[model samples]
Target: MDTDLLRTFLEVNKTRHFGRAATNLYLTQSAVSFRIRQLEIKLRTPVFTRKRGNLRLTSAGEKFVPYAENILQTWGRARQDVALTDSYQQQLTVGATSLIWEINNTNEWLEQVEAIQPEWALRTESLNRQQIPSALLEKQVDIVLTSEPPKLADLQQVRLTNFVVVLVSNEPEQNMNTIIGLPLVYLDWGTRFAVEHSRIPALQRAPILHSHGCQPALKFLINRGGVGFLPLSIAQPWIDSCKLYFVKNSPIIQNELFMVWLSSNEKYEDISVLIDVFSETQNTC
Candidate 1:
């Protein structure tokens, strides 16, 4: 089946109205209806119920959603794989959360991979924690770097390293009470950090600055002179430069980071080699 037909079906399914979907897809309403009719004819089943002002999917249509999505995803991955030039032996796509990229020196890791495996092409994507699991499962990414591993039977997780999040501020001489008086910049490390963070009453309150990852929180601390918890790896540079100071009395939370990929991946051995490079780099870091 043409992927365009699947695209039209999904768009109409999303909008639930042929006219709206047509407008969004930059096609005429009649064209959208034609595509849906073609899809139904191919499937030999009615995918949508034609009711005036009550557009909805038929039972089969609901079931077809995931299949259509999977087909498109597989098609996209295939395109990427086939697009590689003659110089490349294979492509490895690595997806990581922004914080993971920053703290783990992921760019350097990729550089190392390229140096050792000069024939391989490397691709990196910055994804959030929420998007990692589905990206891995759908073969959208070859590997994912994250702190919390998604609990899925088909995915394999490997521990990269453990990191400590320490409370740091510009004012090193300030005690806990004085530090608490300063604005707190909260960075969402992960579930484990949240659990450990709740134990500290001073860090429990609403933050003056909030971010999903380290860079924003780190920037806020440097520019605005607020206190926040950051991975030691990320905070070390500024701490060394006397830009940020460790809050000695604050609780330190340790979290393990992991890289995950599909267990059934075709390039399992090749992926393992890339991971070995990362592990070796981490050991030296």
Candidate 2:
């Protein structure tokens, strides 16, 4: 099976439109159509149905989607493993969202990795929560540390720790009533938090101020006294120091953190070592 063709099929399935998938894959629409046709011929079944401006998957396509994803993932992992073995110095790129960076425990994990696996060349990047999974898929990063588990079919997630997402405010008196009416500094990754906590009647009407990173959100929370959810691990020091206070106890937000990598990478020695260190650190946290 051609992994490239399977990728094209997956992209088309995701977008549900040939043109859009072509744009995403940087392929001509005709080329995209040809690939799908080739795939259908190989399988001897129709994969999609064309309706009024909508492309719906056939039963075969629905069943095949996960299998296609697994194939691509397996291929990618195999290629990466070969590349790593061929290189003289193994390079491991790790990615994390800003929220993970602010956690003191995560910093400790990095230190432990350096002490334990000093020979491996390590590079780290901070990306938005949404970008971490894609970064891993593209092989731009080797592992992603995230508060939310990735839902992609090909990815494998290793649970780290569960943490509370608390609403932090500079002004203690603001609390729920007054804070809910103010401009809340919402983190870009806070959408899940918002949805989970939206049922809190006070938050439904709050004016939102969006920030791309956690530092800016924390700054906004400090300067403007707006509500934002932050991990307990990161916010605990501030709370203990009386720098930030919880806004309301109503919508208690909590999420599990995961160290995610391609499942095939689990066999690589370098990745295995890092995973063990990360797992130990998370357990301690």
Please give the CA lDDT of all the candidate structures.
0.83, 0.73
lDDT of 2 at 183: 66
Query: What TM-score quantifies how close candidate 1 is to the native fold?
Result: 0.69
For candidate 2, write residues 167-194 as lDDT tens digits: 7777676567777566666665555765
RMSD to truth, every model = 5.8, 8.2
Backbone clashes for every candidate come to: 0, 0
* Position 35, candidate 2: lDDT: 97
Q: Per-residue CA lDDT of candidate 1, range 1-285, in tens?
A: 999999999999999999999999999999999999999999999999999999999999999997897788678767878998899989888888888887755555677678989999877777778877888876778888788888888888777667778889988776567776889898887787778888887776889987987788988899988788888888999999999998867777877767788878887898877666556433323
TM-score of each: 0.69, 0.60
Error of 1 at 233 (Å): 2.6
Clashing pairs in 1: none
- Candidate 2's C-alpha lDDT? 0.73
